[model samples]
Target chain A: MDRNGLEKQCLEVRRLIVKSVYEAGSGHPGGSLSGVELLTTLFENFLKFDPKNPKSDSRDYFILSKGHCAPLLYSIMAFKGYFPVEELKTLRKLGSRLQGHPDALKLPGIEVSTGSLGQGFGVAAGIALSLKIDKKVNKVYALLGDGELQEGTVWETAMAASHFKLDNFCAVIDSNKFQIDGSVETVMGVEPIKQKFESFGWECVQINGHDLKQVDEAYQAFLSHKSGKPFLIVADTLKGKGVSFMENTEKFHGKAPSPEEFEKAMIELGEKAL
Target chain B: MKKYLALREIYGQKLVELGKNDENIFVMDADLSGSTRTVLFKNQFPDRHFNMGIAECNMLLFAAGAAISGKTVFASSFAMFETGRAWEIIRNTIAHDNLNVKIVSTHAGISVGEDGYSHQANEDIALMRAIPNMQVLCPADALETGAMIEYAAETKGPMYIRLSRETFPVLFQEESYSFTPNQAKVLKDGKDVTLIACGRMVDFALEASHKLEDEKISVRVLNASSIKPMDSEAIIESARKTKLIITCEEHSIIGGLGSAVIELLSDSYPVKVIRMGLKDVFGQSGKPQELFKFYELSTEDIIKTVKENLQ
Candidate 1:
């Protein structure tokens, strides 16, 4: 896929996310928009997933460690044919399989159940190690929020991964610079994320998360370099990338779009998105 | 009933045996290998053993993830650290998802000794049993513990087995003993009353039954170790036969074995239940026997409670 095509797909995903979250009435929009391009490229082109046989032994595993961005993941998975697009509207409702958090047990295409921050990487690392034990070559990909770096377990597992030299494991840090509370700088100060990961013995790559070619090239670049260490791609992203009103805005961190504001947000993410 | 074996030892042996038989079985620990007895498994099957340093949450989450992808995983750690510190990971990754993870925690109950309140896991059973689709087991002796460990490993979905640091006597005959998961064991027969207990308290219940027998009070003794399922059949039948119940354990009265028995029998059979356990108080550093006695989990306490309930 070319740069413009990837960019257009990312924008279309953002539009779908906005529309779904708006219809659902109670879904995360801020972090979802922030990670638009990163998720788009990974699920669209990078990941080796067969949606029809989601738990195929040969298929690559994708775990959203930053699971609060369920709306974004659900939108992408629905587009990828894991479930019906209509099920997106029932998110957060009592009987909806689309729970407030990502439940892998109830939903297909979700490799692990996640929502609690920092814990996802530990689970992802295990999956990677298990694949190694099985002598399987399927790569393990985990996408995490930068603010989630505040968790101590992330570093513990990071050090363990480095110590194990799990080159098959790949992690993407969506550096949206904002948490549920405020700016990442103010809330937990996980800056120099690339340096931190590198210090833990990971071969690090820093790139603009909005740039699809850069993201794909970086992922491919990391994959090619079998340096006996895991890869951590620190993608610099806006908190709310696509929508003008929500970009880098701390207020939308967890707030669901109101009924009145939903149309305008949808209009911005309409058929002709950025 | 003097010479006893710690359940952790039994779990460690069982893990090594299972690991040797199945290459897919991976054992993950959180640096407390000495206490949890996972070191035995590690030494036996070095290739499949993973030590995650002092990170309990990582150990648990990693185990669940490994289980999801074809590894029959057993995660071992000290109960206090695993249940007290890494609760969220166990809640979300293992139990909430209902993953095929057998979580075995040693140093359970006040019998963990000198470790004091911070190290002893007095509430792990309650913490794990509350989760949906989760099985809770606390075996009384090494024989029962061994059987429970095998049952947990073979069973599907998530399971939490609370093992002990304090070794109680191996009371049952291994040749004749069999543990049915989620089923209560009816050890002794009586018509006047039923004495239900689990883990360390099983010995006390048996002793109390003997003491009461001398007093001409025929009290039935039950090893209701499966805390979550609570052995409704045994509880119901015993309740019908005896019309009174006396439950004991080495945990809190609020959510441990005593509470479980009451919860099971509240609707139909509202019999009088005398609970003998730590009276909603934290434990302090002391000898295992001293602590057990102080918490009223001793044979004397059980006997007294049984007599009081009979009246």
Candidate 2:
């Protein structure tokens, strides 16, 4: 798909994100919306996953390390035909496979179950190591929240990934800046994120997370990396990028949009208010 | 004089043998390869073994990932760190997903000795048993450890094989010994009283039974190695047969084999039960034998408990 087509998909996914969270009555819409373009562009172009055979051994693995953004992941996964797009309505509902957090056992295409933050990245690094040992070229990708970097295990994984020279592993930090408590800067700063990853021996690049072209180029660079080190893409994104009222606010970090706010969010995302 | 062997050393040798046959067998250690003896496997299959540094959480999560990729992974660390520090990771990631990761940890119980309370893992069995889809095993001797490791590799899903830092007297013969999960081994049968024990304490229980025999008291000994899917049938049978039971371990009295036997017998068949272990206390720096005597987990302690309970 061209950049223009990918942008349209992003809009559609953003709409789905709002709708899913709206229907579920609660979710992290801000972080979910922030990761739209990064995930949209990756799924459409970079990620080598098959919708038909979701468990194919040859396929690339994608782990939502920041599992609170399940709304976005579920939307994109649904859009990419892993499951029925209409089933997005079942988000966090009883007996629904769309759990509150990403459960790999309960859902196809989820490589690792990740709700207790920092665990998915560790699992991702391990998968990368496994693939490396088996001499397979399967790439492992993990998307982490900026606030999630506060976990010690993330750094532990980062060090191991680089120490093991896992060039096949790529990690992206969805740096939307707002956590539930407030701004990430105030709630234990993870700034100098690029430098920190670099110090940990990761080949890193910073980009505007919501920019499809930039996200595409960053992934391309990771693909072409010859540093013999793991890759880290520090994406500078906006909390609730597509929506107007919810953008840059911590209120929507976890709270669901009210009926009126949901209508406004849909209108802003170029979708009919349900 | 009985010959004693270290369970961790047997574990390392058995893992190397298993790795030689199965190409997909992988070993991981959290920087304690020397202490845990995974270094032996690392020496042979350097490509398949991973030294995951001192991060137990990362090591377990990594083991889960490796297992997810269809590799049988044996991850090792001290029991305290493996089960305590990385407990939630084991519960949520490994056990919850039912991954094929065998966590064979050493330095379990007060028998860790010299390392003090910080290194001892008196609650590992309890922690592992509480998790769904997790099978907990505490081997009685070198042969059982080797057999349990073999079983863990062949079996699917998460398993925690607890090992002690101290060497134990070998009880089972190599040709005759067979490991079956949830089945207790009857080392001796008597009508007066029953002694159910796990790990190194099994040897002590046998000695206690022999001492009681000299005193004209009949005693039965059951090695309750499989802790999670506990030998409920053997426990109930003993409760019905002997009417008095004493459970012993080198772990805390709160939740190891003692608690497991009591939980099973209390529900299925009620009997007079006395638990002999570290009664909710931390271990200090001492030799394994000294720690056992100081903590009152010695064979003499078992004999005294049986005599007191019988009277």
Task: Give residue A266's lDDT in candidate 2 (0 to 100).
Answer: 86
Question: lDDT tens digits, residues A238-273, model 2?
Answer: 998888888897889998999999888888888788
The reply for model 2, stretches above 4 Å from the true place, is none
DockQ metric for all predictions: 0.80, 0.81
Cand. 2 TM to true fold: 0.98
Best candidate, lDDT-wise?
2
Per-residue lDDT of candidate 2, residues B215-242 (tens digit)? 9999999999998898888889999999
Model 1 chain B worst lDDT run, 10 consecutive residues: B302-311
For residues B4-96, what per-residue lDDT tens digits would candidate 1 score against the true structure? 787788888888878777788888898888878889988988878899888888888788779888788888888888887988888878887
lDDT of 1 by residue, A1-274 (tens): 6777777777778887777776666667899998988888888887999999998988998899999999889988988899998898788888888988899878988888889998789888988888887778999999999999999999988998887788899999999999888998997798899998999999999999988778889889877987989999999999988778888888788877776566667777665322
Supply candidate 1's per-residue lDDT for B141. Answer: 90
